[model samples]
Target: MASPGIFSEVRDPSERVRQLCNYACKVDIDEAIPPKRYLRSGLEMMRMAKVYQEEGNYESAFILYTKFISLFVEKLPKHPDFKTAPQADVSAIKKKVVASFASAEKIKAKLKERYTAIEKKRQEEEKRIQEELARKQAEEEARRKEIEELEECKRQEAETKWLEEQEARLQELKRQEVERQRQQEAAAAAAVAAAAAGINSGAPPNFLNNQIPSAPPGNLSYIPNDFGGSTKLVDIDSQPAGTGPIIPDRDLKKNLLINDGPSVSSPLPSVDRTTKPPAYDHFMSTGSSSGNKFGLRDVIIPSDLPRKFLVKAEHNTLKNIETCGILAGKLRHDAFVITHLILPKQSGTSDTCVAEDEEDLFLYQEPRDLITLGWIHTHPSQTAFLSSVDMHNQYGYQAMLPEAIAIVCSPKFNETGIFSLSIERGLVEIGSCRQKGFHQHNKTPPLFEDSSHAKTVDTEKIEVADLR
Candidate 1:
């Protein structure tokens, strides 16, 4: 360290202190503030360092920089009181430190270029002000020009619209003329085909045709099966034992399966009025040309279902929660009997849940030899609607058994709704939809077991057996 030559020479204490720092630390200060204290404000140290470096005194600048780095940039953050200081303030100090660390020659060039930059900015500001004044004057000139252009554009638009209207009218008339000619040609072709058929059958085509006129709109109670086509109803009991398999009626949509013998003479099947056969729900499908699709045409719950299961579901419903139970039983005669109601273990909130112990529940059913028919659950709201999760679960059940159904009981609304995937529309849509969680479905599917037809099992025949 250099010796302080001002060893009691200056009368003012501030001046003496400045001399001491200048001599000992190679730093000069305008005031007598301590070097360490000045460096405490990192920005102040940076300004002092720049001043020293620009003035060709590199030693003082580097010393001040070393003090600034040690005190503010690094050590201050580790102190408990300053640990939580603003990050932005710390970053600003860092940037200044980086700028001050430049070489002496680099610092001189940057400082000299700064004055030139300020002058350039002043000139730019003056130029911008002049351009704004010029633009205000030009706006008046453009006003008249814009009005002339606008008038010319309006005239062009009017002319274009008139031409378009005329073209559209001509095209419509041409289409009507083409349609008139097509209808006349079709009538002539039909007349020729009818006359040829009359000659071949030796009778008028309309007379030989067994087609009946459709009923008036007021008389349409139910659409006769096969759209009013004359059909000889075929009953299974009426078929003779030794005869070949019953030939399916044409509109039955069954495959053209021929028997192993010679062809039959009459295509008409025998009809028996005494048979009380089950009525089946049917639809016309065209996606597949051969084979008819059948679902459980209708499901009839006895007017006497056990009340215990309903009692439990009603309890959960009142509390605005949910509960699920399974309906399983043996296939008695031609229908399913609800002999058991097993409430399985599950975890869910008011909206959704997963049924666990399904494998075990199903395994137990295997020993009892009962078929898993359908499932029933209660909703807090009376809407009795299926959420997207409900649909996915139904998809698995429906896939396993085509006749499987979903029953939703909304005790709040006193609503019980039954739903099934429409083999044509419902099953195809639900089976194809792979989305999960709450999602949108197109429409409510047709139900094989509707709430309106959910007959209560007679109390006399009702019995409760919990297999939970």
Candidate 2:
């Protein structure tokens, strides 16, 4: 559909006014109008325009002012009554039209100033939000870097301490080796001195009485002697006090071999176990055991919801007109709970109801942090089921929240039911179907069904706002 006017969305007030004037000049006016009727209509229109201006409705006032000036200044000159009117009346009308034109100019300037200020404030707000986000991201990055540096420092310190311990072990092993060799050399010299004394005294060599000193107390290994089949102790070291028996040389070397790479001392990355997947908790709740496996949380409705909505729609029901209301609520304890029913300003027929001024509805819900769970509408004379229009509307709600449900009240039929699209088939079919208004769908696999995830609770009260 075309716009109501060519200048409707134009941002520049002067340009918009120029376009409107051009369009108005082309509009045909009734030439048979009486002078008194014209004057009366102009007075009423000007009065209304002043009222709109005083109420801070500058756009409406500007449009009215423009229309008034256009009719009097552009079209009135062609009117037969305007030509034959008294000279004084014509001059008065001309003066008023000129005054109205001036008023329109002032209104246009005011509108431009108002819109410019609004745009400036909006831009500033957006800039502030972007700066805040950037500041937070910078702080987070700094923190992440600090954590990494701290972990690196700790890992390096651990590796350095390990190297120092290994160095100390090597020094102790070298000292023990030197002590063992010195003891062996002293024992061998004493044995040779005793044998020389025995030869000088001419007595039988008392090798058994002056025996050589035993080597060490640790696990011993012997080497073959050149003199016959006898064996002699080679290198050995005593066990350190209080430590378990010394490891053998071969086993000790194997244990001391460095690994292929340094062992890392950094901790494993932290996991946020508290964070739950967006909507999984709802379907995984104990109450949602019977629903389809789409993992949507159960929705709790007030038991008195149907009765309260019916009472709100009583006037429309009696007149055989449909009444619709938005269902709004909050998520609590892993479930969506209906807390408010908002009836927006609307017009309805027997089978259709359209809520208007939806921005007003958003304004009302925003401050309270309300979620649009779904909607409730009366069927009036029809049965309690969703029409094609309702299906499309519900699609939007469900898209916002998979568990959203539509409630239909049929006062004449004494029926009330809560419903949702069949996730397995209905949601897809209705989402893809483009036909608007009341229409038919395949009944073989029903397009909608009773919502298994929604149940009524009598424990809480549901608030109502009749914006109408």
Candidate 3:
């Protein structure tokens, strides 16, 4: 018979199976039951089933246990230990074992179902988290784009306002200039009319009407006169009497009568007025021919060339010549210094060529010595560059000024053009490198070849100007 603890005492079926399988071979049975018969007995068969169950062969163990229970019930037990050799109640034991097996199966099924449900929940939670993160990222990206667009709009609006203000200022300046020109024309007409009236009235032509007092006759001596009666007269000479004028004694005639004055034919000998006269004779000397005189005077100094920022040369020599027109001025009085070369508008293109206004140019003065003589241009295309005409022009320009620089801006390549001359030595082929920062090497082919063997080209030098 099976052990009593197998089902009645063992709370865990798995533990019961382990105990039975371990003690199965040591259990002693009646010799009336042959050894082979004993091994095949119901008790032994049940132990074998439990061993199979412990080994994870649940289907085989369940079948073996069912058959053993049925056989045990059909064959009654006749053990000597039984008081009256009561027949074994195998039906009840069989029912209990079948119920344990069903319970184990149900437990296994519930565990599998729970595991599946947990895994599904975990996947759903992970997906939710990922979706939330994506949503936040998208929201942030949208906000960033919105802010950028707003900033761009604000910048564009400010630029538009600035342009409008500049246009208004330009219009007002043009009106003022027109008014000034009208006034000038009116003044000129009035002067002409006055001259005509003087001629008609037979009066002496008063060409000196607007002239101020003249300076003294000597080259170094200055004359003093009351100009608007505001400044005091400062006499520059202090000397003894009868010494003659300040003019050197070597040439008396050259320093005497500067013009046909009233004292030209006076009988007094020519004497330098710089000599001191007697204190008592001061009043009398005032009326003498050599006394102080007054007349309209003009002081003239050479004018500077008009300030410009661009000059085009026709030949290579001309292009190389350093011209004042191409120089840029230094910053003066919080003003900007800008230099630009404008090209004519291209034909058939609706685009208008814009240039910096004269008002902007008037804001600063350029340095006269740092002028750049850029390339010349004809109306060939709506561009500015060294064409054959430009090269010829540069050759001529270079001959005049060897240090001149040239830049040719062509519309064909838009912003890319040839700078035939660099402020530094050599030509720099400027084109779109599509890069940032300073260029370390040239990207284009050399425009000119060396004069030596002619096989290799000596590119233009790139260096900063040594401006003192």
Give the top-scoring candidate (lDDT): 2
In order of TM-score, best first, we have 2, 1, 3
lDDT of 2: 0.67
lDDT of each: 0.50, 0.67, 0.33
Tens-place lDDT digits, model 3, residues 208-321: 662323322332321122212222222223533322123222222233322321221223443432322112211001111111111101111011111111223122113332
Question: Model 1: which residue pairs collide?
Answer: 302-456, 302-457, 303-456, 303-457, 303-458, 304-456, 304-457, 304-458, 305-457
**TM-score of every candidate:** 0.35, 0.39, 0.23
lDDT of 3: 0.33
lDDT-based ranking: 2, 1, 3
Clash number for candidate 1: 9
Collision pairs in model 2: 282-297
Better model by TM-score, 1 or 2? Answer: 2
Off by over 4 Å in 1: 1-300, 304-306, 444-456, 459-468
- Candidate number of the best TM-score: 2
Alpha-carbon RMSD, each predicted model: 44.8, 18.5, 55.9
lDDT of 1: 0.50
lDDT of 2 at 60: 48
